[model samples]
Target: DAGVTQSPTHLIKTRGQQVTLRCSPKSGHDTVSWYQQALGQGPQFIFQYYEEEERQRGNFPDRFSGHQFPNYSSELNVNALLLGDSALYLCASSVTGGELFFGEGSRLTVL
Candidate 1:
């Protein structure tokens, strides 16, 4: 079975540029969650989508937004990105509230 996948293993951008990252959830999974992991820190939840609707959201600003498709694939969008927004964008898929399976993530670098 296929596992979760993410594109653009690394990227570089300047301040105020928007970026979009893609993810495909693991096979047989229905929920997809997005996380932001800064250097040397654990991943922080940004939002989760199930059945194409947002189910849970974390303490992220409005600039952080996401969408999930019927196939359990997801995309994260950040507008007016800042230096602070530079981090590893991780995508995790889970069936319940316990552990989550994550993708390698797309590392965003703001210069």
Candidate 2:
């Protein structure tokens, strides 16, 4: 039984570029959610996916999007990235009540 895991652990990009982060859900879990956590701030939900469809979404711009696979893994894509986009991108998994179990996150640094 594996918990959620993220790749690259860290990433670097420039303003106006694009970035993608990956996530694998916990075993036996079928829901995935993406969150953005700025330094010294709490995580803000981006979206949630279940059964390969988006079940819920947050107040994010069109530049933020995501995909969930049949295996329950997910990817978060951000376009035309900005320096303000520099934050910890977290992937969380849950069953019900939305009590999220988070991963270590993919840290993005916009230069």
Candidate 3:
């Protein structure tokens, strides 16, 4: 009965570096969505994965990408990371169009 889970809890990277964050969705969930939350701001949708395909994406640049596994788990990868890319990356799982359960989030800091 585990809820959503995110790995690496924290990270530090330099500009232009690439980073990958992982997530395990809650049981019985089939949709995984990635969000970025900067300090003092609300979460911004990065993209969503369903059936191993990207079903929807936000206003983020092309550098942000994601994948969904058979078990409904997911990964978020950011290429050529920038200072402004540093934020709390959240993984939210839900039965498509239903209520979502969010993970603790992986914090990234770019220097």
- Pairs with steric clashes in candidate 3: none
Model 1 ranges off by over 4 Å: none
- Best candidate (score: lDDT): 3
Q: After superposing candidate 2, which stretches have Cα over 4 Å from the reference?
A: none
lDDT of 2 by residue, 10-75 (tens): 989999999989999888888999999999999999999998998899989989999999888999
Q: Give the runs in model 3 whose Cα sits over 4 Å from its true position.
A: none
Summarize candidate 3's per-residue lDDT along 24-46 as a digit string, tens digits: 99999999999999999999999
Worst 10 residues of 1 by lDDT: 93-102
- What's the number of clashes in each of the models? 0, 0, 0
TM-score of 3: 0.98
Better of 2 and 3 by lDDT: 3
| Ranked candidates (lDDT, high to low) | 3, 1, 2
How far is 29's C-alpha from truth in model 1 (Å)?
Answer: 0.2
TM-score of each: 0.95, 0.95, 0.98
Higher-ranked by TM-score: 1 or 3: 3
Estimate the TM-score for candidate 1. 0.95
